[model samples]
Target: MSLPTKTRQWILASHPTGLPTYGTRTDTFALETHDLPALSANQILVQTLYLSNDPAQRGWISPPSQIDPKRLYVPPVQLGHAMRARGLGRVLASQNGNFAAGDLVQATLNWVEYAVLDAGDPAAGVRKASELPGGLSVTHYLGALGGTGLTAWYGLVEVVGCRSGERVVVSGAAGATGSMVVQIAKGVVGASYVVGIAGSEEKCRWVESLGADKCLNYKSATFEADLKEACGDGVDVYFDNVGGQILDHMLANMKQHGRIAACGAITSYNGEAVLPMKNYFDVVSMRLQIKGFIVLDFMAKAAETVGKLVGAVQEGKIRVGEENETVVQTAFEEIPGTWLRLFEGGNQGKLVTKL
Candidate 1:
């Protein structure tokens, strides 16, 4: 195979005030072609195959003025630079001893057709992706078998310590990580009952199919009543994915000493302000435990977590891929729009762009 001398990229044109728009007059990105330079020693050049579009991208592209210096995770994408994104790619060529051509890897490949990465950069967090014994696809590494599954597993197992007969409720229930959490709660932990909250009836139905005892459509006028009724007794574990009004509702419905896993807050990602929780006092009154976690926090346990999830998957206990993902295959030029779809509720489960 011959290496291409040029690569196309979507450069960050400007930061957005709220929800991001792309490929339009007010687009936040600009497409450009650039020369692909030769790899330096200890560098590997990768051809991107798939890109992971995540809610975190909103925080990544937030204007510096809108972000508090103390709260930032990864640094924001600089203006005129390739838009930051994680991707599954193949090693097209390598000058590094740790990698070789034809190796599949997962890393921060950005929004470019090709990228040259330093093999030793810890920030890159490159990992070799291999087919699992259970016959999971490479794309699963971006989803159920990767961060999505890991996030669900780590939060439920490590953070919440979910146990048998506990009642589990997951917000963003039909989404990638939320869906995984729903299945793991019922299948892996043997939760007596599991409930999911999603934005629409269609999504709620999908969540139910994932083994939830019931799924609530949060968009309905009677959402609060429905949620309260479904809990009946109380929620023992809450896997919070959207942390706004839904969190407030969950707070009100928690059992004594219930555990809440603070995952991503998709609802607040596009908003200018994250409102104060109205029922936050319940934490003290009910002796509840609220814990915030990022999947990166458990890198030391990645191998162990994956091993458990893989076994559950192989046994058909924890399901993946039937409504657990939405993948878009398009030309590289459409990549920007595809990412923007995340905020628009344009996808179900894990959103991936096949480049």
Candidate 2:
């Protein structure tokens, strides 16, 4: 018996404005469903169950030559190309003896319902779908247990090298990656003090619930003073997700020899004008060690990191949360607009599109 094939996909139609807009540059591609082609010796076919929507995906669509030199992380998505995404799926057919049909897997598939992948393909890096441990959700594999989780872990543990009894500050504290950074710094490293900055009072409270010793709303009039007061002991490790002004303020408060992990700069993602840092002299005076990295650079340790995180979650040592929104059938056309919502501070957690 052969399985039927037909699929709908999202494709890039044109470059986006400062923010993605509806009816501007996104289109749906209806692909003819054909019989599952015989896979090569190392190929597998998967049916996507969940599609991940990440900030980095936005950067991927920007013209390669036009993106800021510092922000180039992955190859640009060519116009008319299938939008790239990471997804959780179950194998429906396999040519590789290592993976059998019905095996749950995760891979970087296009934003479509089904994908044909080659296990030996360097880009795919297919792995068995992680089993959800007690009190953990499968979706977490795409968020806390997956890429976002790894981003937080590597930035703190590897880049920032957070130490016990150190004072730490994290920007974008209410976000999926930032939330995990707070918990990992406080619960895992047992930091002496942990401060979080977010965009809303409700998000500030949410950050506090995750063990941040202090939480401040970046949108508040007194945000800078409040942040300074919260970290009076001095910041030893600054995990920055939103750069620009928040980074400038935090740099002013860093103690000598402090380390900063420069993560995503969502603050500048939507801006038409670049914000200049007038206080870079702080890096020189404080002898700060500032490092920037992408999560893909740490893929070699993903399995080990996932194991540790799973252990932490199972022992009640660390808490995890997720914010998700469903893209309605008609709303498929609204993806570009929906993507822009992230830059406007409209999303609370990991955003995903369900097919």
Candidate 3:
């Protein structure tokens, strides 16, 4: 099959200030007739369909000088670089025996309309390229059945070791990973209470709809009180997506031997001064364990984890609720402005760039 002669991509324009600003942090590059390099023996060309915009993508490009030394995450995006992102795409051309044209695949295809990569590219492995299940939208493969779902499964099951009858709390409850954590903890483990903290009342309600026993709006003035009242039993596990204050609060209320999974810290991503947690004493007194985890660490187990999650979805044991709001950009020119919308708290659920 012939590779497409041109591709459109979003490129990094400048470093961000505080949280990411779309136009400032990103720019779009258009290649009307760029030639595709000849594919190597184990390579394929992909046509991107859905690109994920995650909060972690924000931290990936945060300036080193601004980031805290103790908790530095991914490095900043280099200027003039094609922005890094996870995308689901269809194989348009293939030189590898493992994949072929028309095969649907997922890869780190970035925010672009097309990409060519070797099957062995660390970011371009093909997990499932064909035989998409009936009744499942391809987009779910990028969300519930993809990275978001895997992250939740790994963090809750592996890192936090959530158990039946324990109380679990998730920060960033309305977001993708947070929402999945609530459902998996409650549905799979039968947690006594699954509580979620989201940014708004609507998001709190959405979290509750996902089987969370209680959901609190962190944006409220009485958030701490609400959180305390919601978790009648002290939290046994905290799946922290937004760290900083929510973590500090959870730390204060953690039960003896409680486990905390430190996922992405969206709360502290904007470079605002994070207040020190006054509850370090609790960690020692209660013998609580707080461990940081990167989903990349569990890539080896992704297949096993994804199989279970896909089965759950297929069996109707868990619901993959769609937050179908899409922020469409005109052509490839608007990506930079679109990307920045994330830092301002302007997006909900998964942000996918439709190229």
Candidate 4:
């Protein structure tokens, strides 16, 4: 096999002040052709196949001074470096013992078509995608059977400890992780009433199809009243994905000792300060328990969790990419725009780019 001596990459040209925009003259990201370096011992070369566009990408590219000191997962993508991203790829060649040519892997492939990764680097999160259970499309590894699905499972099952016949509410209910929460809360866990909050009526309908009893459009003028009506009794569990006014509403409507799983805050992902909980007193008064978690926190149980998720999907208790995903089959240059769609509410569910 002949390998190219050079590779095209999307480098972080400058820190983004807000949602990143890519164009002919943008500093957020700049495409450059660079010479590929020879792989050292225990290094593997991979050809990127698909990329995941997540809300977390925004936080990963913010100005270093702006990011919260406590929330630093890893150092922000440094200037002039390839923009960090999660992707699925195929091993093109390898000097590593664990991997070989043609092995499908999931890792932090960044915004490049070709990547050279060290086999021993745990930060790369290298795993064999081909080893996942059969009968599922390759994209499901990035959606239902991947980190997205695992986050939903961990938040709902472990953090919130949701139970049968409970009243559950999910914000961003039509999104990737949120949609899965709806399925598990209602269909799998047997929640008696599941209310979903989405951006539009179309999304609301889709959320209902995913087993929500009622899906409210937060953009509506009567959204507050609608939320009050949706929560006839106080909510027992809340799966919160957006943390702004909607969170305040959920806080106000929570039952005494209600549990909340703070999964992601898309409302503030794009260079905005997280909105303060005006109804914070509700937390004290009602004794509401809210815990925030990231998917990495549950790495030890990844395989077990993924097994359950696959079981649910196989039994048709949960729907995956075909019903709840939007794929962009475009070139690498369009990746930033695909990521931008999350903040803009331009996508229905998990957004992935097939390169």
lDDT ranking of the models: 1, 4, 2, 3
Across residues 1-355, which tens digit of lDDT does each residue of candidate 4 receive?
A: 6986788888888878877777544568888888888999988999999998888778888886788645777678888888898899999989989999999999999999899988779989898887545455687788777888999999998988999999999999888888999999987888999999999999999999888999999999999999998997799999999888899989999999999999888898776776677899999999999999889889899999998988887788887757778878877777777777889888787888888
Relative to the true structure, candidate 1 reaches a TM of 0.95
* TM-score versus the correct structure, for each prediction: 0.95, 0.89, 0.89, 0.95
Top candidate, metric lDDT: 1
* Each prediction's whole-model lDDT (CA): 0.88, 0.78, 0.76, 0.87
Q: Give the TM-score of candidate 4.
A: 0.95
lDDT of 2 by residue, 213-305 (tens): 889998899888898888885789999998888898888999999999999887666445657887789999999999999998999888899
**lDDT for residue 341 in candidate 1, whole number 0-100:** 85
Cα error of candidate 2 at position 43, Å: 2.1
**Candidates 2 and 4 compared by lDDT, better number:** 4
- Tens-place lDDT per residue, model 1, 1-355, is 6898899998888888777766643578888889998999989999999999888788888877877645876678888899988899999999999999999999999999999998789789787888766555678788888889999999998899999999999998888899999999999989999999988899988889889999999989999999999998798999999898899999999999999999988887776587778998999999999999988899898888888998898898988753667889979989978988887788888999997
lDDT of 3 by residue, 158-225 (tens): 89888889889998777778888988998887888898888888877877888998889888999999
Tell me how far the alpha carbon of residue 71 in candidate 3 is from the true structure, in angstroms, after superposition: 7.9
Cα-based lDDT at residue 237, candidate 3: 94
- Location of the lowest summed lDDT over 10 successive residues in candidate 3: 24-33
Better of 3 and 4 by lDDT: 4
Number of backbone clashes in candidate 3: 3
Q: What are the candidates' C-alpha RMSDs?
A: 1.8, 3.0, 3.0, 1.7
